[model samples]
Target: MSLYGGMNTAQGSNSCLCDLRSDTMTAPDGAMRAAMAAAVVGDDVYGEDPTVTVLESRLATLLDKEAAVFMPTGTQSNLASLMAHCGRGDEIIVGDPYHIYCDEAAGASVLGGISMNAIATQANGAVSPADVTAAIKVDDPHYARSRLLCLENTVGGQVIPLDDMRAAARVAWDAGLFVHLDGARFFNAITALGCEAIELANYADSISICMSKGLGAPVGSVLVGSSALIMQARRNRKILGGSMRQAGVLAAAALHALDHNLPDLERDHANACALATALTEMGAGDIQLGSNMLFFTPRDKNPDALRIHMADAGIRIGGQSPAIRMVLHRDVTDDGLDATITAFQSYFTKE
Candidate 1:
């Protein structure tokens, strides 16, 4: 099967097409591969992987954190952070649709025995301070102790405003809860808000950043936090079997992505906006544009039918109708974008 579940040519097809399924579909380019090939290797389990150390330190400095630790995936990174912050039977407040609650396989609860208090998120993807206030449990013995507040930026392709995030974090802090940010799309949020990484980091006690998404690394995520928190997360990482040996090759790709691919996110954002505008003009779908993602809902055609048509025309999309997410990445070209636009126009015109 294709890396993105059951989609694309991996389902026994021969078409090498434009894939809009997710930014996770991105592959490392030539320069990234070169960096990985030339990386000086060492055992990360012993804290001797220089490349990994550099990547962690760079991100820590950028986010203005005291320390950082690399993990195999964002799922593990976020889980380790949770395990470090809260003990068994403790509770964390999170948005109902956020990845930590809906996705991640409920790792926090399953592995750490941490309870999740899911609150309704606003349309803009921000959990209100009032919701945070309402969710915090008292010192009563009957309720799970609320120990953490988790927030995600660029949730479902919407950037939660910094002011909103600060307000939410303030609420969490006042309630004696630590804040964790699932910033898998951290750079996308940074580009959208035109803010420095440290500015965003100021609102959260810890952040989990995925390099394999828009950053275009082959694999790896990093958790950045205070030195004590990161040290605890490192121990949790080892316990979760996330500690690595000879991990510099993977870290090198992430380093290359930070140096090279991050600046191109603005282009991806522009492409997403352009595609959203085209779909809007064609009356093809209900479009919601967010940074580097576009949600398109077909107005006059079945979503499955549209999917097959696009696939036949050498384009791939994900999810079922009424809304399909199309993500722009460093790998998707302007020609691919034009071809995708043409494919949609042809399908709807024929209808």
Candidate 2:
């Protein structure tokens, strides 16, 4: 059972439902709310918010970085990191399907005049070192200088192996490029790998960690790097209007999540695997299981009809076929998993 219980139930007419759309749907539990309410808050813009300061310091230590800056969203955190690393007409090497290239609204190019050299990513979510090496540009006026390489852990929920990360980072560093990790699902990857977070962080020059996703906090992401890099990122954050006042309320919730919810991410992963197994057994869809996420492609039923059937059963999903992603979080209970499996079973049976 979840400490937060069923969040979909609270949304009205969806009582005791399962929301598989995304882990971002999680709401803070009562314990997290209590922490928020009791948080010691000061103006964060002035860098006096004690809770925010603690959260940043703790994350910095956990990731073995010299400093960390808190931002309102993961998008802004990545943008700040990008802007801090690259200058006008500079480029970053990134995976084509990764969040920094596809989901972040092109803030680097739109706001900082940075270009992205998107390389093809492997099915395992790693960009090949050969591709990365080939992407680095020479110092020519006609070409954009490749200043940095951006990588994502758990890209599309698949954890990138530590060996692969090191290889890619080595390729970047040997070419005189800095490395940044979009680690929005850093803990999820850590949980699945059964490794310390610092192990992953050691491979990158900086990392952006989201507290709101599988960690179950309502908001906030942290950017961790060397003090000099963080100082630059802080300025970039301010330019992007990510500076917050009295942000400790949100930080406290993140603190609570780090303390209470992180350990349970493995449970969400187990539930995802269980759901995938059940879906596979029913011949409902082709299933791809990753840490706390499952992608299903219906075999016998129409995708739209399957979606409508699940929606009617109070089970919500996201994306369009050939694959629909279902995310598990702290808010999704074992019963919710059962309901989801049954919904799929029923949908396929009636076809």
Candidate 3:
């Protein structure tokens, strides 16, 4: 429908117009671009960007936190929050599959000098409270001080249950460890859980909510927490070279998305379900259909073969080990989904 063409051809057969590689692959629409163009700019380093301030404030209110700071990326936000919460040589308990552990380049260990202690994560992305308890270091001078507990919601798009979050929080509170949430796909989690964003935020000392993902902002994330935590994160952000001179333009788009786009996230989830179901019918592979993400192990495990096949057809998907990850986002339309489904069906039905 609105195929604002940026088609990059790949060497295969036919291709669908939909780009489901990752939400990060989404391009800001014309309205978002227009908002960015007309945005009031200021030096965020001096706290002078009116638009950035408003966006931060609004995010804080939505996340039910005392304050918020806009970050250039969710990775930076997560790293800054971790740095703000823990001291050097401190350990943080986390799920083995957490973005901080797997996706992010061990920033806590290399940059912050904080150690990560991984606990076995359940299929739903929740770490056992017993595992968290066992992971906490005792008051031994020989051990790294366990100072934080990290959790990821919608871990790879599978929503961690609320009770699991509460249990993890209780375990962390009992051990005097601050809890941090890597809520990169938090909107998906909130929509899936049928709860307010704060319901998840309340269990953690801080949250890193991504604007560039499901929210449809071109780029940016927001870290929300107590005023002190955010102030600390601000300094860490500067240290990490994340302080922007004219970030309000980006903030404006995030603001637009919060008002106009947040309500439509459920549609993306629906699209994901439809696509997942259709793929299952086509015998694509074993699919983990959760939230707005579908992780499927292709019947053909050759990554290069499958990637080249899909690319030739024009549908871009994220290749993650044995699983081919297809994410539904704000820009991918219903028509696009239908096209994607048909393309996959045709591919599988062929030799």
Candidate 4:
């Protein structure tokens, strides 16, 4: 009765549908659906959704934060946290390749009227602490106030170690700037680091944890921080059109995910490592496995061909151009991985 097995059988293709596109593709399992159906409901806009309240409380406790607010997506959670912590004309230091900088539609600037100062990230997805120190703005009427330092772990599937995060946080704190973490995959990093989520959360004034990523919830992310910050974030969420009424149904699934799915992430990580090893052996570009994300660049610059070939084989992957990235999730299995390996080998062998 696991929801993990299904294949696209309409075509003549024998390939099992192994969705490695993103963690967003995962469907709610039976337990998740059941939890949703049976969930106690209340108006979350009025701060009364019992399920959501439980989820927030649980996440806050897990992260050792004073409070938590549930939001529609990781982007919203991160933006709301940033909006809460920073003011207009404020600048936030972030890595050049971070989701906020490269993705996210520049909400920090457009909506919050904040400026982003990009710092170079090392190959390990960590910025130099010295760079953070140097980026802090001098108090001047002409210069934008550097109010916050934002960090992303598992950046583009590259995990930054705890020491790097601590050093950066220390630099930001010494500069009197608030620190925020776009921890969409904080759980994955925690599992990978063999540390409690708080170990990372402690360094940042706010941390955004995604329920829908490795946790396999159908939707939502949690932003955890001090109670005052969460109260402010709730207002920002409302402003951003994220306030939901009677959202406990979704919160129930998230609760189910936290309880049942977190431990299974190790399997996903293992599968990623296995896939990386296989792809590297098959002469694919360096396969870097970080938690559940496997970023593999091809030896040649033919990402389009690889994408098309995989699509034909019914194995969905993401990314194009210079490099192709693959993510392993609970929906993918050891058997499905074999099929993916076969598909890749078949595609490359003929080329």
Instruction: Give the winner by lDDT.
Output: 1
Question: Model 2, 1-351: lDDT tens per residue?
Answer: 121223334444235488887899888888999999999999999989999999999999998899999999999999999999999999999999999999888999999999999999988989999999999999999999999999999987898899999999999999999999999999999999889999999999999999999888999999999999999999999899859999999999999998888889989998898888888788776888889888778896356677667878888776456577789998898788888889888888887
Clashing residue pairs for model 3: 12-312, 14-313, 15-313, 15-314
- Please provide, for model 1 over 202-285, each residue's C-alpha lDDT reduced to its tens digit, 9 standing for 90 to 100: 999999999999888989999999999999999999889869899999999999999988899999999999889988888887
Candidate 1 residue pairs in backbone clash = none
Worst 10 residues of 2 by lDDT: 1-10
Count clashes in each candidate, considering only residues at least 3 apart in sequence or on different chains. 0, 0, 4, 0
Q: 2 or 3, which is superior by TM-score?
A: 2
| Candidate 3 per-residue C-alpha lDDT over 1-351 given as tens digits, one digit per residue, 9 for 90 to 100 | 012112344322123577787877677888998999999999998899999999999989987889999999999999999999998989989899999988788998989999998888987889999999999888899999999999999898899989999999998998788999999988889899999877888899899989899888989999999999999999999899869989999999999998789888899999999988888888778899889998888887765566666656667777565787888988787777777877787778884
Residue 321 in model 2: lDDT: 65
Give the number of colliding residue pairs in candidate 3: 4
Measured with C-alpha atoms, the lDDT of residue 223 in candidate 1 is 99
Off by over 4 Å in 3: 1-16
| 1-351 per-residue lDDT for model 4 (tens digits) | 112212233532224478786776788888899999999999998888999999999999988889999898999999999999999999999999999888889999999999999999988999899999999989999999999999998786677899999999999999899999999988888888888887888889999988898777888999999999999999999899869888899899999998899899888888888898888888877676788887677777777677768877778776544656678888886777898999999977887
Residue runs of model 1 more than 4 Å from their true location after superposition = 1-5, 8-15
Estimate TM-scores for all models: 0.97, 0.95, 0.94, 0.94
lDDT of each candidate versus the true structure: 0.91, 0.89, 0.86, 0.86
**Candidate 2 Cα outliers beyond 4 Å, as residue runs:** 1-16
lDDT, candidate 2, at 143: 95
